[model samples]
Target: MNLILLYPEEVQASGQILSLKDRRFQHIAQIHQPQIGDRLRAGLINGPIGEVEVLALSASEVQLRWHLAAAKPSPDALPLELVMALPRPKMLKRVLQTAATLGVKSLWLIHSYRVDKSYWSTPVLSPDSVHEHLCLGLEQAGDTLLPQVHLRKRFKPFVEDELPALVAGRRALVAHPYQAQDCPAPAWQPSVLVLGPEGGFIPYEIAKLQEAGVESVSLGSRILRVETALPVLLTRLFPLR
Candidate 1:
């Protein structure tokens, strides 16, 4: 982990020595192997970025002084919200991590006709599982804020009822293979991007999104997997950010 991420509840009081015994402790002992007086980069989730000075180390735990006075604001997240058709369980884990690492502050995982209903029942969708994946991403990026994930299991109701409100007054784009315009250039404006499953969204789904004010955009001739398409799309959409 590039940054040690601690939640508020983990540290009961400020200015006190904190002990870590979780995966972070294992990482410090095995990977970092720092001597006393050495400081490691650390951050509090949704809080500040700083460091922890090693006070002592043992097999069971590592004690550190939480010198967070130098803590600064976390890096800004991308000014975009992602709307995606949920992929299978295995792909979901990687997608979640990539989205978080790339600074997507909000994610909407919804159902499309091609999406398998069984995929929703996977343990990866559980709150703990999602948090674990997101934390891994934050640690990799040295970021403090956790991305929000919204689940919508119904396709028709979500597109017709909720999506319009979600995209109101925002530049919305839906990735499609046919009848699509070239993807727009990256900008700082607020935007909502909708992408589809492994095979891409069905025609009717695209139509509904278009009716809801989302324009259709294309990547290319070749179809891409959900995992591959997501990072590619996000990077293209916010290339400079």
Candidate 2:
């Protein structure tokens, strides 16, 4: 990993000391091959960027001491938010990682008519697993800020009860492949884009989203998987910014 992440508990009275027994230890020892006194970039989750010196190493673990560095710059204040239909477990990991890499500020794992109920119960939904995926994204992009992720289990209530406030004062677009206008390229204002499941949104779901101020948009005639569609949509919607 580019910037090794540390937990709050890992920080010692002497500053930050991470146990090499952690997964990151393996990453460093195997991939990075850092030597004692060697410095590496590191960060606390949702916190500052800093440097860590490899102080000691062993067969079982490694020890690190951190030197406080400048606080990481805040991520861009993009108006774009993603409300994505829950994909399969494997795809979920990729989606979260990709979204994190692209600098999405917030992500909602949304439920829709086409979504499989079982997907929500996957172990990948656990906080630790989610954080792992996000960490990979951060390392890939050399970014330290973590995106906020929200899970919506009920489709109708989320749409009828919560979506309005979430979309307040911003444009909302729902991506569906059938009978919709083309998806617009990224614009200057903040926008909330809702993507449907692999099979696409049902008519009733689309109607409810529209009632909640979402405009239906298409990504041309060819239907794409949720993973493929998400990056394409984000790039198109936020090309220059």
Candidate 3:
């Protein structure tokens, strides 16, 4: 980990000493290889960005003195919310990390007709695993904010019930391979972009999403994996520069 992360509860009195005994200790000792008095950027999960001075280390734990000033705000909010088909465990980890890096404000992992049912049972869906990936992404970009993630196990009900409220005034685009418009330029208003499974959205799924006011759109004629297509969509829709 480039930067160490702590939750609000981890910060001790005087706000100077923070004890880390979790995976972060291993990352610092083995990966970062910091010596005593080595200062590293650190932050609370939903709180502030600050600096930590390494005070001591052992095989399984590290102690640091923290100095927090102000928390860093997110770079920018994409006018986009991602509603994606559940990808495999490995891909899910990568996508969640990338989405956090890209400043996606919200993510909905929904079941789709083509999605593998087994993907829902992955341990990666646990709170700690998800937080780990988000922290990695945040550290990658020197960011402090975390994205909100939602899980939807039923495709039709999500499209019919939860989706309408989320997309009411926002432009909604569904990425499909055929007979759809191209992804649009980022506008002043927020948007919601839906992506399909590895095999793409089935007809009924597409129809239901459309019925809920999601417009069909495409990256191109060529198909891309969910991981590849997500970053492309984020970059295309919200060009950084």
Candidate 4:
């Protein structure tokens, strides 16, 4: 982990001291193996990035002094919302982590025609499981702001009832292979990116998205997997300076 993520609740009652005994402790004890006076890069979830001075360290737990006054704000979040067809469980884990790492503040995982019904029943979708993977992503990126993930089980209802408002004033683009315009210039403004399932969205679904104000766009002739397409599209939509 590039940044040691500390939750607000984990802080001691004094607020300036924090203690960790979870996997983070294991990581620090094993990987960092720092002396008592050493400081480590750390951030509070949805808070600031700063250093934590090791006050005490042991096999069971590690105590640190939180330097909130010296902390800096986390990186600005991308002004984009990612709407994606829920991939299978295995791919879902990677997608969640990648989305978080890329600074996507909002995510919608919806059903698509090609999406397997069995995929919904996987344990990876559980709240705890999702939080863990997202944290992994945040730790990798040294970011603290957690992305909000919305789940939609019904495709038609989501498109017809909810999607229009979601894309009302934002530039919405749905990635499709057939008869699609090339991905537009890097959009720094508020936008929505819709990605389809393994085989891509069916014609009717694409039409529905179009009706909802999501224009069809393509990432060239080479069709990519959902996991591969997501980061590529996001990077193109909002490239880092």
Better of 1 and 2 by lDDT: 1
Worst 10 residues of 1 by lDDT: 7-16
lDDT of 2 by residue, 138-195 (tens): 7776677788899999999989998888888988988887678877766767889999
List model 3 lDDT by residue over 1-241, tens digit each.
Answer: 5557777787853356867887888888888788899888887777767788899998889999887764455466677779999999999999999988777768999998787899999999999899889888877766677888999999888999999988898988898877798788855568888989898889988889889999988798788888899888777776673
Displacement of the residue 28 alpha carbon in candidate 2, Å: 0.6
- Candidate 3 backbone collisions, by pair: 16-66
TM-scores, all candidates, are 0.95, 0.89, 0.90, 0.95
Clash count list over all predictions: 0, 3, 1, 0
Q: Which stretches of candidate 4 lie over 4 Å from their true place?
A: 12-15
- On the 0 to 100 scale, the lDDT of residue 24 in model 4 is 91
Better of 1 and 4 by lDDT: 4
lDDT of 1: 0.88
The candidate that wins on lDDT is 4
- Candidate 4 lDDT (Cα, whole model)? 0.89
**Deviation in Å, model 3, residue 19 alpha carbon:** 2.2
- Against the true structure, candidate 4 reaches a TM-score of 0.95
